[model samples]
Target: MAEHPAYPVGLRLAGRRVVVLGGGQVAQRRLPALIAAGADIHLVSPQATPSVEAMADAGEIAWTRRPYEDGDLADAWYALIATSDQGANTAASAEAERHRVWCVRSDDADAATAWTPATGHSEGVTVAVLTTDARGRDPRHTAAIRDAVVEGLRDGTLVAPHHRTRTPGVALVGGGPGDPDLITVRGRRLLAEADVVIADRLGPRDLLAELPPHVEVIDAAKIPYGRYMAQEAINNALIEHAKQGKSVVRLKGGDPFVFGRGMEEAQALAEEGIACTVVPGISSSISVPGAAGIPVTHRGVAHEFTVVSGHVAPDDERSLVDWPSLARLTGTLVILMGVDKIGRIAETLVAHGKPADTPVALVQEGTTAAQRRVDATLATVAETVREQDVKPPAVIVVGEVVNVGVQSSPKTSE
Candidate 1:
C-alpha cells in the first residue's frame, strides 16, 4: 500500500526519557546520539554487546537487564523498538502508540511511527537525509547523500561565505608528516575556510593546490639553518594579515609544537592580543618509522621510546639533548631533523654506554611518495647515510625495535 512521505524533524530529547528496547548493534549505534543529546536513556535487554554493557557500566544509561515489559514505555518521550524478540518489540511499539510517544522499529519499519534519518555533522551544522518509499527505503542511498553533503560542507565547497561570521585569527595547524590525508579534520576544514595561508616548505604541500583561487598562499621563507630574522619575518606576516581581518593559517609539517617552533608563533600572536588556535598533527617521530613498518616500541623488544631533535650537533652548545643519558638507556630513540647529524649522534652514543652494533633505520619522506628506509648499525650509520645519500626531513630510529615488524624491504617504500 502507498503511504504519505515521511516528514523530517530534529529531536530535542534533552532531559527527556527515551526508552530503547534493544542493546544489540542497533542500540549500540544509535545510543551515542541519544546520550549526546542529554536524553535520559533506559535500555531494556536480557543481553547486550560488550560496548553496550560498557555504556551501562559507565552510567551513561540505565540498563534493565531484562526483556521488554508492558509498562517499559510509560512516560517515555521517545521509543526505539529493536529487540530480537518480535513479540516483545510489537508489545513495546503498542505501548508507545498508546502513550502517544513516537517510536522507531528495527525489524518492521512498516509499523514504525518514526523513521531515523542518516545524519552527519560538519562545522556546527547537522546534515540529515531521509527517503521513504512504499516498496522500501534505500539506506545506502540516503547515507551516500548525507556523506556527500557533509564532505562538501567540511571542504567549504557548499559553504555560503556571506552567511558565515568571519573571525580573523591565526591557526597554527599541523600538516602531519607530509601526507595530505594525514591532516586533522579541523585543520583541513580551517584550511578550506582560510583567506590567507602562510605555509612552511615541509608538510602536505598538495593541499595548497586545492585552496580556492581567492586564498593567497604564501611560501614562508624558513630556510634550514637560517637566522632568527627569518622566523621574525614570518611572525610579522601572520600578525599583519590577521590585523587586516583575514583568517590566516600557519601550516607546518608534523606537529606544530614538536620541533616546529609553533609555540614561538603562538607566543608572538599572544603578545599581539591575537587569537591563535593550535591544531595538532601526527608527529613524524613515531609515524615515520611506523610507515616504514618499524614500531618504535615492541612487545618483549623495546619497552619505551624517546623522541629528540637532531637539529643541533651533539658537540654544539646550542644542543639541549642529554646525549650521554640517552646512550645509557636501552629504549628506542627516534630522531627528527637528524639526518645530517646522524654520524655525530652515532659516534656520541657509541662512545658512551650504547652498543656499536645497535640496529638503526632511517625513514625519509615518511607516509608519502618518495618514502624509503635505510637500515644500518650504530657504527655504520654515518657511512651508510653517506653511501645512500640520505637528506634532511628524515626520521632516524635507533634501537632493536627497528628490526621488529620489518615488512618493508630495505631502501623501498609502498
Candidate 2:
C-alpha cells in the first residue's frame, strides 16, 4: 500500500526525548539539527564516526555505546532508525511502531512513518523540501533547488518578509583566510545588508564586489599605518557611519581578535556608546596551515600551538613577543607576516633552542586558487623562501605538526 502524503509541521521537540539508533554518517548528519532543536538525544551504536565520538566525549549527547535494545525507544518521543543493517533498521522501526513513536528511517525513507526533508537555512528562515515520491526520483534535483533558494536568500535576490531584522550597527567581520565561501553565514548576511563596508586588503575581496551597488566600500589599507593613528581613524569611521544610521561592516582577513584589531574597534565603538557586534572569521594562523595540509594541533604529536605576528623584527623595540620562550616550547609555531623577516626569525629561533632542522611549511595565499606550499627546515627556510620567491600574506608553520598532515612529512599519522 502506498503511504499517504505526509503533513509538514514543525515539531516541538525542545527538551524532549529523542532516540537515535545509529552513529554512522546519517546519524552524524542529523544529530546537529536534533541537538540544536534542544532534544535530549540518546545515541545507540556499537561504533561511531570520530566526530560523533568526540561529541559524546564532550557530553553534548548521551551515548549508549552498544546496540539498541528492545525498549530503547519505549519513552522516546521520536526515533531515528539509521543503521546500515537492514535487519537493525527493521527491528528499530518495529519497536518504534510498538511504542507509538514516529520513526524516521535513513536507509529506506518509505519504510518509516516520518521523512526527513532537504533543508536549507539563511538569516532566520529554514527551507525544507519534501517530495512525495523522493525514492522514485533523484535527490540531487531537490538538493539543487534547495541550494538555489538558499543562495538567492543569502545574496538578497529572494527577499522574505519578516525574515531578517536590519538594525544599523558596526559588525567586525573576519572574512576568513581568503576563500569567499569561507565567510560565516552571519557574516555573509551582514555583508549583504551592509550600507558601508570597510574592508582590509587581505580580506575576501570578491565578496565585496558581490555586494549591492549602493554599498560604500572603504579600503582599510588606505588608512594611515601608525600603531595608534591607523586604528584611531578606523574607529572614528565606524562610529560616524553607524551614527548616520548606516550599517557598517569592518571586514578583516582572518579572526578579528587575532591581530585583526577587532576588539579594539569594538572598544572604540563602546566608548562612543555605539552598538557593535563581532563576527569571527577563520584565522589564517590555523586555517592557512590546514589549507596546505598541516594541522596546527595534531593529536599526541603537537599538544599546543602558538600564533604570533612577524610584522616586527626581533630587534625592534615595538616587538613584545618572547622569541626565546617560543623557541623552547614543544609545539607548532605559526608565523604571519614573516616572509620578509623569515631569515631573521629562523636565525633567532635556531640560536635560542629550536632545532635548526625543524620542519617548516610556508603556505602562500592559503585557501585561494593562488595557494602555494613551500617546505623546508629551520636551517634552510630562508633559502627555500628565496628559492620559491614566497611573498607576504603567507603562513609559516614551524614544528612537527607540519609533518603530520602533509604526505612528505616524516611524522606518522596518529
Candidate 3:
C-alpha cells in the first residue's frame, strides 16, 4: 500500500523523454495514452506484441529492441517499468529514482513512485480516479468510478447547469446509416448537448426520441426535386438559430459531406461568421452493402470500387456521372439515391457493355431492424424493384463481388 495519499499531477510530456521498459500487454495498454500526450517515447524490449510492433513500425515510438539496461532512464522525464523480469523492473525503478524521474511499476503498486489512475475523457473534461483504501489499492473500483462519471457526462445526466460553458455553434454530425448505436461517441455527446437539432428523415430517427424534451427538432427532410428550395430555408434556419446563441446541430444521415450538401451549410455559416463542426458518420455507400453481407471490394473478385450519386438519370442534362466510363470498369459500383432510377441505370449499364448477368444487390434500411436485401442482375433489377416495391434510401451494389459474401447473412426481403 502507498505510505501516504498519492499527489495527482498532469504532466505535459510533449517533446519530453518518456521511457517505457517493456512492450508486453501492460506497456501496450499504457503506451497509447503516453503517445497521445506527444511524449518522445523510447521503448526498450527484446520483443513486442504485434500491436506494439506496429506502433514502432509506424514511427510513433523508438524501440531499442533489447532488454532494459541500467542507464536506460538516463534522460527520461518519466519512466514506466512493466518488464516481466522483476529484477529488471527493480533495477529500472532504482535508475528512475536516481534520475529523479517519476516511475510507475505495473508489478508492484506500493513500490511505484507514481500511480496511473483510471482515466476517461468526455467532451473536453478528463476524469481520473485513484482509489487507495486502508485495505489496499482497488484498481477495479477506481475504473468503475471513472466509467460512471464519464458515462454521466457523455449522456448529460450529471449536468452542472450554472458552471456549464454553453458555446453556440453549428455541428454537422453524421447519424450513421440508421442504427442509433452506430453513431460516433462525439456525435452522440454533441447531440446530448444540443439545444436545437435539425434532423433529416433518413438518419438514425430513434436518436431524436432520446433527446431531452427541451430540444427542438426541426424536420429538414428535402423531398425529391422540389425540396431544393427548402434547402435555402434550412440554411437560413441554421444561421438564424446559431446567431441567436443556441447550440444547433444539423444531424445528417451517413457522412455530412457524402452527397449530403454539408459544405453548403458550412459556407453559409462561414459567411455569417458562425462556428461549425463537422462530425463524420458511417456512410451507407459502403456500410449498407456490408450490412447486407456483401463486400464492396473482395480479393480476386474486385480490385476497385466506385460510389456514385444517381439522383439524376443517365441522360439528364444535369447528370455529372460518366455512366459509360463507370460501366466499362471491371470493378464494384455502389449507387446511392438511385432506387427510383434503377431501371434507367440498369439499362444504361447494359448498353455500355456491362454484362447483364453481373450480380447486383440492393440493401434497404441498412444497419437497422427494418434492414433487408434485394438481389437482382442488371437485366432483371428494374423488374425486380417493380415487383418487390423497392423504395428510396437503398444502396445499389453492382459487380461480381456482390456474390462473394451474399450467403453469409440472411436477407429479409418482402
Candidate 4:
C-alpha cells in the first residue's frame, strides 16, 4: 500500500463545501474542524449524536438523515467517510473519487486523498505531525505524541518553523492547576508580550503580576461554580481585541483542551478566518496528586490511570462511565468537578467491588501556596470532604497510591 503524502503547506479550508458522511462520535469530532474552517458542511448519516443533532437543529449545517448516495458527492470540495461500517465507507470513498473530490475514508487507509495530521496551532502558524505510515494509528498513541510535541513547544525545546520576518501575536495560555512556577515558558513569553491580560478567577494571581505594569489588565474571570460571562461572549472579545492588532492574552486555569472549552473558542476564531494558536497547559488531574506527594502511577501500585468528569448529564447515560472496571483495575482514578457527586461515586465504586476501605484523597487548591490535602477511605471520603471543607478546583485520587502521601508526610503545623 502507498503511504500518504505530507503537504509542505497546510491548506486553509475556509469557505469550502465539505461533506461528512457519518453521525457517530468520530464524525462529530471531525465536524468541528470543518465548521471551524468555515466550510459549508453537508452531513449524511442515518443517526446523529447529541452534538450533531444540536448543530443540525440549530441550522449550523445541512443534514440528511440517511446513508451516503452517489448524489451526495454533488459539488463537494472535500468528503470524509467516518461510518462504523467498512463497506459503507468504501462506497463513499469510491463516490468521492468519481466526483473528483478530496476524500478521507475512516476505515480504508489507502483510499484517503489526504491524511489528517495531529495538528497544533499558535497564532497563524499550524504544526502538524504526520506518521510515515498513512494507516491511522491508535488515538491514545496519537494523543500522547501530540502532548509530547505540545510540551516541547511549551518548554521552548521544540522551536516551530518561524518566519522571523513576521512577529507572532500574543497567546493566551492556561497555566494549569496551580503552581505559579509551573507556567510554560511560551506562556511566560506571551505574558511578557501581552498588551492586555484577561484571566479566569482560578488562575494564580501572582502569575499575572509577572507581566509588565504598562500592560492593561481585565478581570473577565469565571469560576467553575460562580457566575461569569458566557463562552460565546468571551470568544467574541478575544477576537475583537486581536482584530484591532493588539496582542491579548485570555488565560485559563488548566490545560485548555481538557474541559476548558478551548476548542470552541478556536473554532469560533477559525470561522472568522482569524488565526489563533493554543498552548496546552498541565492538567490538574495528574499534577495535583503529584504536588500532594502522591504519584498517579507506581510500580505494583498502579498500572493505569483514568481521568473523568463528575458533572455530566444524568439523562445522558452514555456520559456516565463504567465504575466497575475502574474499581476493579489496579490503578489510580482521578475525578474532576466531582466533589458534589462524591457520595454517589463512592457508592457506585463500593457496589462495583472496590473495597470500602480503599484509600482516597482530596487535594484542594493543588500546586498553590494555599493548598490543602484531606485523606480518607472510599467508605468515608464524602464525610471527610465535608468535614474538611474540600471544594472545587480540586482533584479526587482513589487507589493504593493514595496511601503514599499519608506515609510520606511528616506532621506539620495545621
Candidate 5:
C-alpha cells in the first residue's frame, strides 16, 4: 500500500460544521473529537447507533435520519465518510467535492483532504500522531503506535514536553460507574493528594472516607431531575479553589466526558489559562450492563448496541431519534437517565413495531451495593418502574438478551 500524504497544517475545527456519513462505532469514536473541537456536527445516516442518538439528544450534534444526499454537504465545512459501504463512501466523497467541501473518506485514505490523527491530551496540551511518508505504514499500525506512545506517556516513562509543568493544582476525576475498585490508579493517587474534596452524590461514599480527616469536604451533588448548582457555578467553584492553590478534587461518577460535563469545565479552565489534566475513567454505559449479567453485544443476539440518554430538554423540538429503525433492528438498546421517560420510550418502541412483550430491565445503581433490578415487558416497564419508584442513575436494557436475564432468574422470583 502507498503512504498517504499528510497535510502541512492541522486545521482547528472549532465551531465548524462537519458532517459524518455513518452511525457506527467508527463514527462514535470520531464524534467525540469533533465535539471536543466545538464542531457543529450533522450526522447523515438512515439510523444512529445508540451513542450517536445520545449525542444528538444532549444537543451535541444534529441528525438527518436519511441516507446521505448530495445536498447534505451544502452547508458542511468538512465531511467524514465512514459508512461500511465503500460505494456509499465514494458517493459521499464525490458529493462533498462537488459542493466544494473538504472530505475524508474512511475507506479511501487518498481521497480524503485530511486523515484524523490518534490524539492524546494532557493539561494545556494535545498530542496528535501522524505518520511521516518515510514510515510508509498502515493506518491501523500507525494508530497502534499512537496508542503505545500515549500509554507510555501516561505511565510517566516517556516525558513529553507538556508533562514537565510543575503547576500545583487538582484534577477533577470521574470515578466511573459504582465500583470503587474500578477507579483509575491515577485517580486514586490524586484523591490521596487532595487538600479539599468536592464530590458528586452518586460516587461511593466509602471512597471519600479514605481521605485524610483534615482535608476539607464539600458536597456538590447534582441529582437528576432535582435542583442543584448550575454547571457554571460548579466550574467557578473548581477554578476558585484551584486559584487559591488548593488541591481540590471535583469527583464525578462515570467517565467525566461521557455525561459528566467535564469537557465544558476543562474548556472554561483553558480560557482562564489554568493548566488542567483529565485521567480517563471507564464509562458505566458498558460496564454497568456487564455487571448485571447483561452483555451489550452477543453473537447473533446482537451485532450492534445503541446507548442513549433518556433525559431530554423540555423545549427541544428535534426528534434526532429514529425509534422505528431501533425497533426493527436486532440489537440491544441501553438507555441512561431513562426512568422519567420510560413510559414514552416504551410506547414509542412498541408503537413502531417492536413487540409489546419485548424484554426490558431497569438496573438501578448498577455495580454498587444498592443495585436493584426490575424486569418487565416493553408494554409494562413504564408502569413497573413507576410502581417500583425507580429513579435516575438507572440503566434500561431492551431487547432479546434481556430475556436471558429474565430466564436466568428463578421463576419463583418473577
Candidate 6:
C-alpha cells in the first residue's frame, strides 16, 4: 500500500508550538517561515548564529540554550530537524512520528515525512514550488518553468476575466518613466480593458501601440493649446466616456500625483458624480536618475533630493519658484520640464547662495531607449545644453551626488 499523500495542507500553527532543532544555517532559514506562520517557535541548541541570537534577544523566539531532547516534541504540533548530526535528525523524527506530528528532516528527505517547497509571494498570492522529491514532487527542471510563471503573475500577464471586467469608470494610471514594462500591474491590466485611452506625451507610448484595435486611442499631445483649456477638455473626455458605460484610462507619464495634474482630474470627476480610480506610476524624478547610474540621495554626499518644475523661467513673473530658497539647499535639486529654461534656472541658482561650481547633469529622454546624459557645472550647463542640443522632457540634477555614482567632467561650474 502506498503511503497517504503527506497531505499538502497549510498548518495553522499560529499560537501553537513548533520545534526547530540546531541553531545553524538550516534552522536559520526555516525559522523565518515558521515565525511568519505565527507559530510559537522553540529553538533547541546550545549555540546559535548571531542572527538567531539577535532574534532571541528581541523575544521573537524562545531559545532553549540546550540540545534537543524527546520532551521537546511533546507539545509541538510540527517539528523540523536541521542538525548536522544524522543521529540527532533521526532521533527527532522518531519522537515526532510517535506523537503523530509531521517533522521535516533536512539531512535526509527520503527518511522524512514532510518536505519544504521553494516558495514566493506576489500580490496577495503565495506560491509554493515542490520539486520531485521523496514526497513524489516534481524535481526535474522546474526552475525555468517556475520563473516564467512567477514573472507572468507579477506583471499581471495572466490576469483573470474578473480582473479585466469592463466596468464603467475612469482609471488614472501613471505610466512609470518611459518604459512600457515599468507600468504597475493594475495599470497594465486596466489598459488592456480600456475602451478608450487618453494618452500623455510622455506616457509609455510603446505599450499603447500594442493595445487592441478596437480600443480608442486619443493623443493628448494634439489637444488644443492653453493649459486650463487643455486640462478641461481631458477631464470632460474622461467623464463623457465613463458616463457612456465604457471604461476610460487616463494614462499619464510618471506618477499621476507628482506634478501630473492627476488630482485635478480626480476632483473634476468627483464633482461630476463620476467614479474615478487612481493607479500611481513610478516617477521619473527618482527612477530616471537611478537608470543613469546616479543616486539622487546618497549617505554622506546628499541626504535629500528636491524635485521641481523648471518649465517656467525663474525670471518670468508667472513662475512661483523661489530660486533663492532652492539655491540655499545643500541637497540635490532635480528639475523636470526645465530643458527650455535651464540657462535661466542655472543662472538663478548661481546668483543665489548655490556654488557656481556645483556639478550639474542633464538626462534627456530619461529611462527610455534614447536616454542620454551630459555632465557639466552650474556655471556652464547652459552652454553644455546648447552644445549637446538637449531638448525638453529631460531631468536636470544639480548636486555632488551625481559625482559619486558616475565620473563627472573636471570642468568647473564657474
Best by TM-score: 1
Candidate 3: list runs displaced more than 4 Å: 1-7, 49-65, 74-76, 95-100, 134-138, 157-165, 222-225, 410-414
Candidate 2, poorest ten consecutive residues by summed lDDT: 405-414
Q: Which ten residues in a row have the lowest lDDT in candidate 3?
A: 405-414
The lDDT for every candidate, in the order shown, is 0.90, 0.87, 0.89, 0.77, 0.77, 0.84
- How far residue 297's Cα lies from its native spot in candidate 2, in Å, is 4.9
Candidate 3 lDDT, 76-117, residue by residue in tens: 999999999999998888888888999999998777788899
- The estimated TM-scores of all candidates read 0.96, 0.76, 0.90, 0.57, 0.56, 0.82
> Against the true structure, what is every candidate's RMSD?
1.9, 5.1, 2.7, 14.3, 14.6, 4.0
lDDT of 2 by residue, 205-293 (tens): 99988877889999988988686898898999999999998889999999999998888899999998889999999999988887677
Residue-wise C-alpha lDDT for candidate 6, range 1-414, written one tens digit per residue: 124444466778999998889999888887888888899988989999998888899898999988777778997888889887788788889988899888888887777777776666655566676654344656445555666666666654554444555558899999999989899878887887688999999999999887778899999878896788999999888888899988899999999999999999999999988889999999999998887878899888898899999989999998988899999998999999999898899999999878999998888888888888888999999999998898878888999988975754333111
Number of residue pairs clashing in candidate 1, backbone atoms closer than 3 angstroms, sequence gap of 3 or more or interchain: 0
- Which should have the higher TM-score, number 4 or number 6? 6
The C-alpha local distance difference test score for the whole of candidate 3 amounts to 0.89
Best by lDDT: 1
Give lDDT tens digits, candidate 5, residues 65-178.
887766778888888998887888888888887888888777877776666777776434566777777346466877788777765554333545333434656586888887
| Position 345, candidate 1: lDDT | 96
Query: TM-score of model 6 relative to the true fold?
Result: 0.82
TM-score of the candidate numbered 5?
0.56
Instruction: Write one digit per residue (lDDT tens) for candidate 1, span 1-414.
Output: 346788889999999999999899999999999999999999999999999999999999999989988999999999999989999988888888899999999999888889899999987789989886746679899899999999887766677465767888999999999989889888999999999999988879999999999999988854333658789889999999999999999999999999999999999999999999999999998888888888888888889999999989999999999999999989899999899999999999999989999989898888888888888999999999999999877999999887774653343532
User: What's the lDDT for residue 182 in model 4?
Assistant: 81
* Model 5 bad stretches (over 4 Å): 1-166, 222-229, 313-320, 407-414
Error of 2 at 228 (Å): 2.8
With a 3 Å backbone cut-off (N, CA, C), the pairs that clash in candidate 5 are: 50-306, 50-307
- RMSD to the native, candidate 5? 14.6
The Cα error of candidate 2 at residue 336, in Å, is: 1.6
Clashing residue pairs, backbone N/CA/C < 3 A, model 3: none
